[model samples]
Target: MTTTNAAEATTATAAARATGASAATDVLIVGAGPTGLTLACTLARAGAAVRIIDKSREFHRASRGKGLNQRSREFFHDLGVEAEAAASGIEHITLRKYRDGVAIADTVTFADRTPTPGMPYASGLIMPQWRTEEILRDKLAEYGVAPEPGCELAGFTQSADGVVATLADGRRIEAAYLVGCDGGHSPVRKALGVGFEGSTDAEECMVVGDVRVDGLDPAYWHQWFDEDAAVLLCPFRGSAHWQLQGIPERDADGRPAAPTLESFQRLVDRCSRDAGIRLSDPTWFSIYRINVRMADRFRVGRVFLAGDAAHVHSIAGGLGMNTGIQDAFNLGWKLAHVVLGRAAPGLLDTYEEERLPVAAWTLNLTDERLRAVVEGVKEAGVGTEAVITDDVTTLGVGYGWSSLAWGGAKAGGRAPDAPCRNGRLFDVFAGPHFTLLGFGRGSAAALAEAGEKCAGLLRTHLIEDGDDPGGHARRAYGVEGDGLVLVRPDNHIALSAGADRGAEVVDRLLRLGR
Candidate 1:
């Protein structure tokens, strides 16, 4: 309060600047999985001084989650790594679900649509977590930020202005915001002492392995369900290995004891019935129990939580990692603005309000899926409801409770997909940034104005391909003739109205982004 105290504070600030670049980071993210890495890239691209740390020494070898949804695929496209991933090991397709001895649920196929809006990508693909991480790491590296592995968070104090985290080695970082992408057993979550409310399925155990299977259909992910056992098989195109998920028991000592081919054989025989083929030595294997749960809240003052730190759920929809990715998408831009003084702290509240219910619904739906599979209820057809809810793949997700008010044409529910010309070829969603789609003459001129006004913050696309306007696209965006739609950084519709309200659209999008 006195001159002496002010001078002391100034000196401390100056000294901090001298050591480690002395920056109170705009965002400090913990964990380096797909979610954290994606957040790092997105935040760094937004020009925020971001720091990311993880407790793991290296990327893990085990295969955890595998399904990459259509929405996520589109997101990867925006990041410019989808093609690389497609070349690596990921197959662009969905799965077929079966039960007992019959194919009850045939997989629904999704085709590639235009770059207009809805999800801005095609149908989902099946890929391993390891490869997914590899793509994300490459993207982050492109942005000149790498994950600080082997660095763990010990504790933190959240003041009104910032979060201070003490590292495992006794270093502290004062960050404007801290988002925990750490897994289920997050040290940050424990520090907050918030309860993770849900039940663990202890009665039924699960066995998973990546094995080399010869002469099996590599095109589709196969599932078999019997009264006694269930088996899930997915092909790994890179190594010619099949990632297997089954029900297996553990030893009395609580050790894995589940690496043998015998356990896998039983599941195969019970479900497949046709024992013409055999499953031999595995490349990887493990056994464990799973739970369906979520955290009560996703925030605590300056310390916020995302990904597994915020919620954990059954992988029925392969949503664990995907949900975490969505958390990062929602939180990244808001953090950028808050640190840059463009938005108030209240903007962060929407993270929990938007994602918590989604997590809860996901957990509940996944549990229902497991129960249906175990109880032989899929035969009745009511069980498939649990399979995919809200397309939590991030496509069906929307910013329903947005804080911005661009009345004439603000963001609505889900964005739609439409075709656009990229000069080279047809383009899909104008993603990785806010995209504006316009119709009618002079639409492109208006979009050009909006683009220049917020060039770095938003991307504008003028679709002049057809005369009738995009059918499904028009309905999804609620635009009729001459109109404009504003998509957010994450590809959700921020504002969807006619191009006549172009000025209002630009104002709302820029302010909301701030």
Candidate 2:
């Protein structure tokens, strides 16, 4: 940890008020990984002061989770960070399932949606975790914030008024809310005495990293499900670089019997004898111990947990970071509202109710993915809906149970995207403002009514450009005509309606966040 100063002393004072310790911060985030960083950026963009601390002194160079789902892309786009990530060697892949080197099943591809919103990233993206972090860091910098590195959360105490955290140096920083975006083994979780009761899987999956190999292929994320051993390989930037993992019977070379280039190579040779391809080189390797577990609760008074601190799951779907990022996304604004006194404390509680169920659902599905591979379902025999729900980036994931959820429209089930007169493809759910979608002139007066009451508190958009937009926005979100929609600050559809229904839709929206 670094030396503390007077500025550090006051950082936690903005989060309402705290008991015991008086340090205040609007949001005190523990952990500067993707989730924590995303939370910081989201809140800061909305003008909330934030402080994020990470135990790591610097960005981790090793690559993890080589695939980024579609839902994540939408969130990143809203943050205005996805553009750089999309350009930074992120490959657009046609997801495929292969068993013993034979293509068996293909995932729901993003190809059918012509000219999707958040284009270039309309589908899944293949980019390394480090690169993703780089983009996030850059975005954070734009907000005049930097992550506090090498400073760990030593201990903390929370109360209804606020959370007071005791630093390793014995200083107290207070914030109205404290979030543990920490990992599965969170210090904050330990301090809170939260119960993480889920059990671990029997399997031990090993992974190896960042090794440059001449013989590896660059086009796809490949998996080999041998009844005895399974291999997962992801290519890096069309280069010889790859991340490989294997389940080993023993720790040869004294390395953890997890994934490594060596083990992957050996497994590749074995699978080749069965399926006929050769793998070479000795690079990075490590083993993963799978645990599909989640905390019994996400919030306890002023203290909250997000990301892996809330749930831990298999690496099967590469969902760990994405899930946490979404966790941060869900909670960031509610905390801001609570702090700014724009909404009631009850709104913050919805964060747990909404995100916890999604986490549990994701953990279960990912666990099944691991089971499918381990049980030798063979990528060919795999019928898993890796992303059946669509909006893999998690942007489409909704909060069906919210006080602000005024009513349901025909597009109630999925995430909505639309063409706008503003020459932009608007995702009805990207946070940072109160969004008003205008289908026609009839809804304009009603929208103005809602906007006038909110003052500088709401941002309104009218979705009235009748042009086809070449079916770009229509196919991406399946909305073909002008329709009014209201998006909340947390990126969820508040209300949707056609021209005739605009007044009714605006009336229901005016009823929200009051």
Candidate 3:
């Protein structure tokens, strides 16, 4: 991290030497975590010039955020990394509870469900955050763009036309837009003077880290809980390591103890006296205090915020990282469209309009879940399973009320996957283009005309009602009769209408984008 005074001096010097050359890229993204990396890959795949930077000297290797929900699985599939991510992950394991070294009960965190044609990934997968980041980084590398490590965003100024950003080492970067995917303490958000309003619970804190432990079964997530303390050890996929989480003892001054090997051992000893678990090879550690916060606004002029920069919440439901990934997915195509002049600049406003409410809702949901866990532990001697429900999977999130949503059936919802003639509905919606789906034979002409009108911007598919006996796509999309559905680049339903109004709906959506 650079000193504030040094950063200010560098920014001043860089601004004083501004030149008339065109910006180096269309978008400059700070923080190379999942959010920034996903956005970079999305934009670069769409032929937008993007540069991603991070202040960290090296890539993180910890199991920071381990739970990938169903919605995130669909996102990875669209990004073409689903196979790799699933290969590197394990299904959510059964959680085994122990009290005083005596096995009490076992339960699955996420309920099992059969995969439907309309929902390919019906369950969540557990992969370390490091693995997810590696996959996204590899995807970005395919576009010849890698995050510049150790490059700090010292300061930046956004004008009506572009943004001038100064790095800690005095390198000046010019971009048409800047995005702060940096974590909770985002430099870009600070520079933009965005208000982050929330409360941090100093009384609630936990120690989290990765370590190699012996004498513990790797099949199930082992958890030991008592009245005042708790310890959980879950095997991290793709490695001989376990992610350890526990309530740390407080110091003499009543502050939460610092996360160290000794503190972790003490926690284990207190929670599991006779489990015989021997912890060693400490890889990473952090004392995490619960913070619930959201940025007052996600955009400021030509600069914007995503991921933890825009909102942060309790990790009770594993919403932090997944929400950030969704934020990047939502922003990527919009940014690309505006940069390529395929859409009006106002299209960027929809990023915040669609995402901010989702963030707010997630914050409240996690807070409620956190309260449930705390209360359940206090009253019932264990956390309730209610914390991990279908809502945690994030499959129900959508933009139903946004201005971009139109039509009568399933409009403004996530476009579900279903078996198509060639592959699946997702396969048709893949890539950086919109999709127009005609649900029955009567809508063929409308689909063809819309495809011709939107040429490179859209791809059209016609699935007759008799094509599949199950009628999965029609049922999933709520198409009662011959209807047309337009899916946005982010795989959300933009418009759905009867066969007669299909072309009109397409024209109105294109005009809005224009």
Candidate 4:
């Protein structure tokens, strides 16, 4: 809701004045959206110098990306913003469906879900994208980093040493690596000559925005559907506005009419057929045409693409922003490690390898869900229920096929959470460091050795049967007797092995540049 002030901008500018226009930073992030901000926070927390910039003159307030899935919550948990996010978001709001002013079915959003020891956060939360970015920006500020506004990336050239990016204002910035989180039409991806391959649905379009709504119950996501037009109004938490999505009238050229507050009210009136329910004070709006696409490659030498720069998909699954955030999460630790000299440069390769498949599958899944939703709308009046699948939650996204996944059956997958004597496994893995969990007393020596070897880079915790009363840790990890699970900084399982193989895993980490 707030942009970086003069002092923060001056601070960022002063920090960048050292190398070229800015060589003091290790990474230069282009774009201040959820993806770029998440990456900036991740890198900054790891003490990797970063300078984030956005071409926009000021932060745009919008209800663009309103859903943060469970996996993304975990990412925020690592970034130290989950508490604020939880306080600012709402969950388990019911969907009240209607047809031509007649009330229809009432469906709970995330019904039949409960948090377990293995996965504490069971459902996603609904918060506007701007609020999410604000939380990230606030966190980034704690590290003395702020996103420079109205800064555009004109072009860039990379070499073996680093990347030199020329801004639109003719200022050059030198960084060890550059990332593009600029969105679907990213100039960074264009500069890299990467191909964005996908199709756009011209026929399917909706007007989406934030609006102050009255005479509607805020407890439910109100939806109204008829034969042609449809409208959905979901209340945003900690605010008086609601996220409005409705079918607008098309012009002779077949384009949806301009997204004005008046136009939105007309659409709502036409669909809901209720004059008492009103819309006003539209803060931000967009004519969302369903776009499904992904970049051919995620990285080119020292330059990389993330978020919408790397992929875009239908809003069916509400995975668009979450995917980008996860892309940044997947790339964040690897970039930090490489930039901070904690890992080999080769570690960055797994970013694309692990996320490319996820994007491809996400595209297919969202497309299918979109089609199903369309069909559901044609049959009944509700369709969003079609998008609420386990895959949409993104908890199942993993990289088991990645080379970094070494020994355990669940290697390269998301490390599960469990209760421990001190707190929880997640409590130990909260910060910007790798986590090595030693289950059983036999692994204590290996824990000590890893502690000394890895030092600040790795956090080791011993989990014995008595330490976890419910045995959730043992079951979640499939640890039989005495074993070790090495979790990457991104919370992905790097490897898992028996107690005797702990030294082997440690040796592998050393070979992989630690």
Off by over 4 Å in 2: 1-24, 94-121, 238-240, 249-265, 273-285, 375-396, 410-415, 427-431, 465-484, 497-514
Clashing pairs in 3: none
lDDT digits (tens) for residues 1-514 of candidate 3: 2211111011221233364334478889999998999899899999888999999999989999987888988988999999999898877567888776677888786557768897888667878999999999999999999999999988887665677889999999987788999999998888777899999988988899999989988888888878878989989666988899998888899988789988888888778885678999999999898989999999887788999999989998888999999999999998887776566677888999999999999999998998898787677756545478888988989999988887665777889999878689898888888888888888998988887787767888998966645888888888877888889999999887888986686677577554
lDDT scores of the candidates, listed in order: 0.67, 0.66, 0.84, 0.84
Lowest summed lDDT window (length 10), candidate 2:
1-10
Model 1 segments more than 4 A misplaced: 1-24, 89-122, 250-262, 265-283, 377-394, 405-410, 423-433, 441-456, 461-476, 498-503, 506-514
Candidate 4 residue runs with Cα over 4 Å from true position: 1-22
In model 3, what lDDT does residue 475 have?
Answer: 82
Question: What TM-score, to 2 decimals, does candidate 1 have?
Answer: 0.81
The clash count for each model shown is: 15, 34, 0, 1
RMSD of each: 5.7, 5.6, 4.4, 5.3
Our tally of clashes for model 1 stands at 15
Q: What lDDT score goes with residue 19 in model 4?
A: 46
lDDT (10s digit) by residue, model 2, range 1-514:
2211121112234332443443446888998888898899988887777888887887786677665677777678778877776776554454455565666655554555544443435566777777788788889999899988877677776544456777776677776677888888888776677799888755454655556545434565565555565555666674566666555647556444545455566776675444544455544455567877889889877778998899999876668988988888888887776565555566666787788889988888777766764454643355333443343455456767655566655232334555555556444345566676555456677677667776544766654446435555445444445556666665676666564664565455344334
lDDT of 1 by residue, 257-290 (tens): 5557877776777777764547876767776568
What is the overall TM-score of model 2 with all chains considered together? 0.82
